[model samples]
Target: MLIDSGSPGAPATIGISLTINGEVRELQVAPWTTLLDLLREDLDLTGTKKGCDHGQCGACTVLVNGTRINSCLALAVMKDGAEIVTVEGLAKHAGQDGAMHPLQAAFVERDAFQCGYCTPGQLCSAAGMIAEGHATSREEIREAMSGNICRCGAYTNIVDAIEDVMHAGAAR
Candidate 1:
């Protein structure tokens, strides 16, 4: 006798084990599922915004072993045993209790978002960009973050927030 798995017309589920936000997680998911879907749907880590799932937009950016990558373009099965860090993970890692990351605080102080739809992605990208030491100047920051489109046109404020963190050496 064969037991039916709940997925109608779908193949068998694959088990994936990964470390996310400093926690070990095990899930049975489809092989083709993207990391973004797993994080949001399964892990409840919705902080990793999904703007353009095609990787054209950096909104779905997340840190993989400290390197920023578009989660939407990555397969969850491919990240087995890898460390995944989303915006929520970053916040937790940067704080002790309920405090926010320096960049998050700077963004708030500078009002870096308008509709705030892109704020999560912007903050995540900014955090990774700053950590990578890729933004040496305002121009570089702007260039590095160009992949993240802010439809609200909060570019100036975004730069200000990132710069504030950079100048304060808080990106470390």
Candidate 2:
């Protein structure tokens, strides 16, 4: 809970500790601060885009405790002590100095990102979806990834890229 600072309007900040991109970070955040804002504004991790600002667009997707959630819809303080992963962390966890994550490599190989605005969210969402191990086929993948939208109309290529990684068993 946020306490008023005894003033007319400023709400006191609450301390939150979140493990982001494998780094443990302790910070203060206002109760109303959204995870997207905390990541982009406070932490300067702008890889997670803020599109629609509502839950409809998957542009603000991020993995919290290994599960994908819409960052824009999530309160930063609510995820205190949680482990979060963004697009920037995927490659680092992929095991090498310059290697890209399988999904990242596949997306590049298949030209999955056109305009690229939705790529970050798509990548994070795909990573989380793959980890869930629910998408078994092309149709299933499409259904599972339906929550993410690409305005550049890269649906086919995105699906193909994800399918490639999924079939190659490179993604967990």
Candidate 3:
């Protein structure tokens, strides 16, 4: 339930519960707060990048219920109770000895990133794309990943890394 402030047109500020990065969080935010701002500003999860901020660049991509969405375009109040997976959450088992997610490892192995500003969003989007089970070839991966813009010209390496992961069948 949203409780509005006494102001006439103030965006309702309400408490919302979100399952983010495998953890449940309770937060009070304005109805207009974007999920990206909630993650970066409030929660301090800076992995998701803020690029164009207009949904043109996929830098704010995050997985909502295993589906990739532009966090910048999604209102936090609307996603209350939704399960979100940020780049930091892509690897369920990761530590000094634990293995990283296949995509993560592939990205490193193939040198899929440069400057790294877009790496987080690219990683999250690729994870969700892999889970969709539609990309079967390099071309398919490229097409599916068209939304994510990597300004470093690492498209070839990114495609190669995704292909490697897909071939290994380790998207999950």
Candidate 4:
């Protein structure tokens, strides 16, 4: 049975398996279904925001197999069998103690967000960057996080928050 893509045109469905937020989900997705839509529309993981929807904005960022990727640019079928982590998953993975991830907490402490629309993408991207272990300095973090646009102009605070987490992670 074909499922509606929630768009005006109901596209044909293709089966895909995704391990999302530590849960294995098997679903039928349209060939044109972007990973962002799959998460927000199909799975209802709305934490991963869809800002530009054209991959220009990093609002749909998520981790796929421990690497940061713009979910808007990826097709759901292309990520079959891949491990996906959205903001919700990152929060859950950080601690079962019900505390926020260090980066998330740092963001708040540093006032890294204004309107908060880009916070999810920024947090996920920073978490992934820390996992990548390639960025160690403030300048490096700035460069690495350039893809995520915070229209609120909180770049300095965002970098500060990310740096705080990176240093803390290093200590642990």
Candidate 5:
């Protein structure tokens, strides 16, 4: 478990602990603070971008016990002892020497983003989506990633990038 300092506008300040990536961290946070807030503001893990504070956007997506979930919609207090994996975590696990994840590389190769604001969430969602066997086709990938809005309108490139990873995984 991990906890960090609370934000100024955060709710009730309290101590929090959670398993992030593979490390346990404890921090002082507000009771009403969201997981995204804690990760970005407290833990200094800004890889998970905040496109929308509401669940409507998947920009703040992360893996909770290997399942993809919106961090913005989850409260820090509710994630005690939960295994959380953020974009940074994914990159680390993809290689020991800081090599990029296959999905990340594919995204770069495919030019899957424009402003790159949504790239982190898209990559995280794609990683979990592919692992969960939720992406079977271009249509399926589109449907699964519908929650993540790419304001840059790079949907086609995003789908192509995800497909590249899926095919590569299948070949392996």
Candidate 6:
């Protein structure tokens, strides 16, 4: 159900469908609109931040098709029909439903964040890394998460949270 927002070229707009946070969103966006801009500005999914917008800071990291990527470097049009999960989607199911994801709970238990600005990206990156399942040690986790920068210097706690989740998954 992609709605034709407008035509391409001159004032060209393209219609794209993205499954964001388990919801299908059909939107009309410009070709040059980066995924970061599209999420924050158009879709109003601001959980993916815009730090260092050049794909360096990884603040705009999100899960696209089950892989972690920097949204700031991706064009919205390029991700048509992709399944995207932002930080907002991480804990959608909560309370009695046992909604909070393990990573989220671990962050709270480990005191994984300081300024909290980088928490979203950090969470998303950890989720993706855990899914990838290549990192098992603290050093590997840090290396995998190097793209996301936390200026408040909460690296140790972040690693602890991620490691807890990984080991828990192994036990399961």
Instruction: Please report, in order, the local distance difference test score of every candidate based on alpha carbons.
Output: 0.83, 0.90, 0.86, 0.86, 0.83, 0.83
Across residues 1-172, which tens digit of lDDT does each residue of candidate 6 receive? 2224454444557888999988998888777788888889877888889899898988889989989999999998999999998988876522214467788889899999887888889888888888898888899999999999999998999998888889888311
Candidate No. with top TM-score: 2
The lDDT leader among the candidates is 2
lDDT of 3 by residue, 1-172 (tens): 2334467877657888999978999889888789999899888889999999999879999999889999999999899899998888888722213567788899999999988888888888888888898888888888999999989989999999988988887776
Which pairs of residues collide in candidate 4?
A: none
Query: Candidate 4 or 5, higher TM-score?
Result: 4
Candidate 5 regions exceeding 4 Å error are 1-13, 170-172
Clashing pairs in 6: 93-99, 94-99
What clash count does candidate 6 reach?
2
Could you give candidate 1's per-residue lDDT for residues 56-125 as a string of tens digits? 8788888888788889999988888888878787767665357788888899999998898788788878
* Candidate 3 CA-lDDT value: 0.86
List TM-score per model, in order: 0.90, 0.93, 0.91, 0.91, 0.87, 0.89
lDDT of 1: 0.83
Worst 10 residues of 2 by lDDT: 1-10
For candidate 5, which ten residues in a row score worst on lDDT?
Answer: 1-10
lDDT at 61 for candidate 4?
94
Which stretch of 10 consecutive residues in model 3 shows the poorest summed lDDT?
92-101
- For TM-score, candidate 1 versus 4, the one ahead is 4
Residue-level lDDT of model 4, residues 54-79, one tens digit each, is 87779999999988999999998999
lDDT of 5: 0.83
Model 6: lDDT of residue 60:
89
